[model samples]
Target: MTNNMKNVFDSSNTYGMAKTFVLISLYALLIAIGMHKGVKIFLYIAGISGALLLTYEWFKMDRPSIPTFFIAPLLFLIYVLISPGTFLIDARLAGRFACALFAGVALQFFFSNATYKVLLSQCAALLTTLFLGVTYACIWAPEMFDDRLILSYRNPHQLAVAGAFSIFTLFTYLSIFSKKKQLLVYCLFVIIGTAIFMTVSRSTSLGLLCAFAAYILFYRSKHLIKIVVAAGLLGLIAFSILPATQQQRLIDPFTAPLNDRTIKQRVGIWYTALQGFDEAPILGHGLRAYSDYDSDYKEAHRAEMVDKNILIIDSRWAHPHSLYLGSLFGWGIVGTLLLIGAFIPAFRHSSGRIKTFLFLMTFFSLGYGLTELRIKSDDGAFILFFPLGLAYGSILFEHLSQKNKTTSEYPIQTKPCITKILTLLN
Candidate 1:
């Protein structure tokens, strides 16, 4: 390829950087617009447009090594086709998932040794920390200042998913940009960590704690203890400052009964899920189909009638609480396996530290999925895959670059276990 044509997809050129900027902008816009139907429609359009442009740029240069990259979407597609009469078959929902999968596939094609090297280096960490600090303020300050735009922490699932994304973004920054100034970024991370706590998402809280431990153990920050302390103090202050209703939700016991209901009433959803699993133990009812049955369970158990309009809310929010349950309920064993398979690549090229981080995320995802359907959330989608992709790209690029080096002056040792494992996975 001529230098001019090559520059369009050049690893060192501005094209990738510009695309990243556009992608980030679009993400911020989508989040800012929130979850209204109109906003979701616009988001699907924007997501597809970006994916198309990135795809064009990618195939014009490199091709993906594996076609099994289609596994995730294929599972989702099967669920949609087979789901029962009342399934919430929203085209926008399918579009969002498809768009996310495309983005990841396109990323692999575009990710190069040079890009991976830059992402893994210390400078990347500084940039990430800076971005987190700014976004943290952007999300928090609006809530702090304006009464009309009162931060809706009503949706714990969304809060947890958003918090997970923020935590991943912050860690990615720290991992890539480890410098003296980057230490200051950890302080900012503590602040972002505090905001996560304020969201009061039990799953998110757990995920944030897991991420914190990973950062401390792997990144080895000397000031980790102080950072932890600051996080606790901030959590206390945030709780102390919120309105009484919000505070109750924040401090309520996990087992507390909702709406002053009976134990059966409170646990009705779980019981129904268990029963449903028995009916179709292997394949289950398909994604989002659980709530079609949930409506009947609620009507039977509910003393007072729930709004008919709100009945479909759970359908929009379907996915059994446990990731294991969700897997079984949504796609049966086959679907669950495909979902798990999506993450196996994270284990192939990464080091012990990165693997631990990825596994912790998977663990948290399993825990979070047990009670919430996070896969539908935009924030959750981004959180689940981006770090894995970045780390994988970083390690793979590093390995490829070292192989290309022709000098005896410097040689890098490849981990034997990693080498053998990646060979098999590939």
Candidate 2:
């Protein structure tokens, strides 16, 4: 076997798997702990480690695929560093985000092929575990049954986690069913869905429904009508059979009104952000600096408002909740454009079906961000970008010749002529 070929098949040196495991484990732990910097630190170490390995591999003459589109964001990140204030409020946050991005890029370079699949598998497994475990506890924990077993009873974080697990389970099913990994996938999905049903995040329920419709309409369009009927039937069965908390969660989106505290707060936040944007239309106040200035905004608004409690209540929540608005508010037109630039390649290369899914995620996030920042924080950032990155990276990798076709299957046997010649010459 050629030296390069030998390197590719080396079981102990699979860069891809390493990257995947690190990313998945870190993300899972972050979600569980709510420590954003911890995740970044982990990635930073992984990136450095991967870069070192990549350097060694490069010496062996293996060609790595360069992620051409990432340049736009990288350049913009640099611009943030050099550009004076009014553009960036907290340079540290911008720098940190850039560091995180570089770490991810380093991972891509170090294990371009293996990371995507491994990350997917990890996401499927980790989310499945969390969902199933939580759901099981809620359903069977005799001691806590009254307080914690029900869906709405769970805290917001749990609800979000459960909702995420639901999506993960669905994706896992698609991955398995598409790839013919049937029995395991089926069992996993059931566990995941049940867990999600327990969280009772109404928005999650809505997102899942929308995702299902999109999945059927585009990817499985031929069986669309039947699938919808089956889904409707399944929904009916689930609501009828499941706990009241679960049922209530499933119908939450339609139930949450504009006057609801959460919704009302989001409106207030939107107005606050709009005012911030107005102060600087071209560039944002600065990345990750929203909360730093929210006090002043709230105080000013309070002076003109009815109640101090209403003006400042729940203002502890940072971020405007909408990513697009947040980006504009923080990074301005430059940052927003850079992000759009980064996403463009993925969009261009993706099929209509894949693109539709991306759009759903992006769209939902936009509205959802108005209430919660799901893309800026570390855990949220990983959750937001990793899967989408994987999906997009998968599309990008598919077009490349180097990506492995079957990770599970043994590689074909072949002689390493280059290695033989190199040894002889040495």
Candidate 3:
């Protein structure tokens, strides 16, 4: 994993820098593995590494940006702290969120200055790695693509979301920032795009579409027709390649009985979660409280509904499948608003390729969250925070770059408050 990140980051000690880069890269790659259990190990590694780095930096001369974006995580913590019962009550859920949050915040400082390019480059490489894994899985065990390219994910939705995000990253950078490698980037885009379509995750697929459409509208609406036509053709070709039975499975989600497949089952799940929201409309019961609520109360209700044949007996998975609804249950209206704090300002003062990438992620998350509890789960949380940190880091680094440019143009007026403070201390 670290070798994949070689030459992307550097430091005074070339050997140590390479080692650190490898460690960080490998940790990120581990999280990107798409499996539920495997992602956790890297979570601790990243969170702990960030913690130690920040602790040491607290006393060192070299300092990182203030991370104004970190207020989002801070607010989340505060909201969790004042929730109904004791902190220990929601320790399991709360602890996971805390570690993920720390890992994200720490990342904002990890690749400092203009090293964000390295991070984005690393993302493209990681995506390539993931796609290669899927390719191998498909050829070695074709069954992996039976329902959807399950890849290493517990389900297709996870793979779908990750691949979609990777597409957004690759496209944003290659198109807007580094247009030098057009053909190669387009090929990579097609490969990952194929993987996303194969996932058969309708919500994630639509989320990617909506995000891409939005990107066009915001920037290149004039060529919308061409883009749409090309995309439609591509989709048709991808679908045509699917086996007849697999195509039926893809269509069943839309036409099948509500309980038997996915869509209707989702409707039932959403209805149950909304019921819980009604019970506590202000501050939610607590983090991960939905599981117990569903088991004790909603489950019995669903079972009764199932017996009456009014609804299907689709009570397999857990969580309310919607980030908006998840927030409504876990944090309530006010807490949900606070949670948004963690995301909204990430694009503050950003523009061009960076802005597009962040916007893609932001809109994608909202769309994906509609039918998936992306914010609560480990894979979802890790994937989201890592990119978010990149977005925020880009913003901070850009700000610094512009400031330096401005300062260089006018070097006499003021050195910088830092220089003034240092002079005083000296």
Best by TM-score: 3
Best candidate per lDDT, number?
Answer: 3
TM-score of every candidate: 0.60, 0.68, 0.76
Q: Write the per-residue lDDT of candidate 2 for residues 304-338, one digit (tens) a residue.
A: 54453343454465777776677778767776787
How high is the CA lDDT of each candidate model? 0.49, 0.52, 0.62
lDDT of 1 by residue, 221-339 (tens): 88788888987887787667656755665455444635423222325556556666777776666656766767776566454335321122233236455556655665566655766
True-structure lDDT of candidate 3: 0.62
Tell me the alpha-carbon RMSD of every candidate: 10.1, 7.6, 8.6
lDDT: which is higher, 2 or 3?
3
Please say which candidate is ahead in lDDT: 1 or 2. 2
Regions of candidate 3 where Cα sits further than 4 Å from its true position: 1-37, 55-70, 85-95, 98-146, 175-180, 252-260, 299-316, 395-426
Clashing residue pairs found in predicted model 2:
1-415, 1-416, 2-416, 284-332, 321-369, 321-370, 322-369, 322-370
